[model samples]
Target: MKFPSLFSPLKVGPYQLQHRVVMAPLTRMRAEKPSLAPRPLNVEYYAQRATPGGLIIAEASPVVNTGFGSPGIPGIYSEQQIAGWRKVVDAVHAKGGIIFLQLWHVGRVSHSSFQPGGALPVAPSAVAISSEFKAMTAEGKVVEYETPRALETSEIPGVIDAYREGAKNALKAGFDGVEIHGANGYLIEQFLQSRSNLRTDQYGGSIENRVRFLMDVTKAVIEVWGANRVGVRLSPYGIANGSGEADPMPLYSHAIKSLDPLGLAYLHFIEPRSSGAGRAEVNHQNVPSAMVLYRPMWSGVLITAGGFTGETADAAIAAGHADAIAFGRIFISNPDLPRRLRRAYPITPYNRATFYGGEQKGYTDYPAHDEMAQA
Candidate 1:
């Protein structure tokens, strides 16, 4: 078969996948109102892309009310939200696809308008992000991010508890597993990187201290879903959401060594060039591939994302760099992406304008390859 490595079956934790193509977590923001529940539209959207034997990591969902980074972003902290996710899980399962929910907390990337009682967002340190960030308010208005408050050391346990509870809720929602959103300048990334986390307490300073929060949350979630079913995502060169480290190799290398013994499902890494958020002004040509830096330290399954096409993805797996590849935009436009890639068919480009906060037009209206041919 063409792209033999890409089309080969691989084992991830307890489950065996038919192919190595994974649906990356892409935020479309089509969830239902005030409750931030996954709506019927979400079910149809995911179901359409739920190619049997492929794995799908659903979009990022806040673990608590204060963790919200945008309007219409789904949450797993409520009973209604759990029910909403159950529908999504059931839809994907019906199509014989395995799905995982991405647990997230935006941390300092949020605004006071998205917080309760107009409270400022919280982070490991009081240091305000120096980059530009826009968030949708509760009233449907978009505004710039406000300076965030430094989280008290005593309050740190509460954040870990939120992740534990979210994992439990994901189980109740019938998800096969949960992926900790530790990348893209979110809460976990905020704590891992030096620029965003300036705390002198046990949660910051040295690389060991900086990674404490990530370890705590991972342990907590692993308690709910075993380490074999848990995965962590990291963006070593990510400058998105205004979080970047002056020297990240040592920090992430240390972090991976620490997590290696956990026997986790997989370590997901976003490639440097493919970070869709913000860019660091410094030249990134010297930054090495995450696989090259992390493969020796981590022996478990590795999933690499960011700007990989069919040919490149196959090349990555063939070169023994990664076990699987996650496609974000490609899966968005091509619901039957595996079949398209296997057959070497042309793909339909997605409409960037209607990507977020939209109806069925850009969300579920994209026709499958066969449907397009019949049209």
Candidate 2:
């Protein structure tokens, strides 16, 4: 009753959501080591955040062995991995929550150390990320990104197959749906941006050509999960992971318009002034709002995430800029996020140091607000 619109019911595809505070797909590098699977610890974390009828887009999971860029992040390619994710999906569903796995391939955002045979990371082109950004080695050391090997036209289909395989694995894992990781300078985005994509094939050059790979990947996932159970995340005006289009409007305009007729469950966007770290909330001037700019172009349900508080979230929905708001930084430290926000409870500040690669200390130790009062 507090934030009426934020707490209001909404229909997403076939599922009816109880609230609009969707959990953003966060990359917390804490999967079971060595095997790179979701262990009991990972299951407990997701279960703690599950709310009846609420949606949680689980962390970005590499689809294949070569898709990995960071250590300890879970993979969905192996039998062990599928069994592990099954536990996670079951736990969330037990609490009546809907979960989606984000299929990902890091592309040139990776280093050779993480590659199978010490091969250079693959991308649409062989261009390296500028010195401003660095890649993390499998050993945990950070190094400059190398110029990735361009995929031979024939090899491109194999990469798309990896995403299709991941989609099938998500269904086997018992997930309600799956989201394609087409944003952030990953493989799909490597093919979307002109500077990073310099091929003369059907997947490069014009905007339509640049968008081909995304459509291919989307259609592939739809074949596995169907259009209503699938979603796509894009960053039209973003510069994350050293990816930026000099002119994002024309490229993203075509991409959104192209996807409009697919009838996906929803389209998610990362605001230009935001990232999982939450630092982009400050000192970011002249950054365009992703929802405000593209909401008109998209016809289906639209979800956007950035620096949003309870009041701002409701305002966005009330103003029709976005149908739902995804929270990242604040959600990490607050398990009962929807309830606390609905009641206007004090928010727990997150420790940036422990945001990634930690154990129970910063992972599942955040007590619910009721526990704080009972203490």
**Candidate that would win on lDDT:** 2
lDDT of 2: 0.91
Per model, state how many residue pairs clash.
Answer: 0, 0
Tens-place lDDT digits, model 2, residues 1-375: 354488889888889999999999988899988899999999999999999999999999999898888888999999999999999999999999999999999999899999989999999999999998888999989888899999999998898899999999999999999999988888999999998999999999999999999999999999999899999999877788888999999999999999999999999998887742432334355889999999999999999988899999999998899999999888999999999999999999987777779799778999999999999
Looking at model 2, the pairs that clash are none
After superposition, the stretches of candidate 2 with alpha carbons farther than 4 Å from their true spots are 1-4, 275-283
Candidate No. with top TM-score: 2
lDDT tens digits, residues 177-258, model 1? Answer: 9999999999999999988888999999999999999999999999999999999999888777777889998999989999
Off by over 4 Å in 1: 1-4, 140-142, 277-287
Clashing pairs in 1: none
Which 10-residue window of candidate 2 scores lowest in summed lDDT?
275-284
| TM-score for each model | 0.96, 0.97
Predicted candidate 2, C-alpha RMSD = 1.7
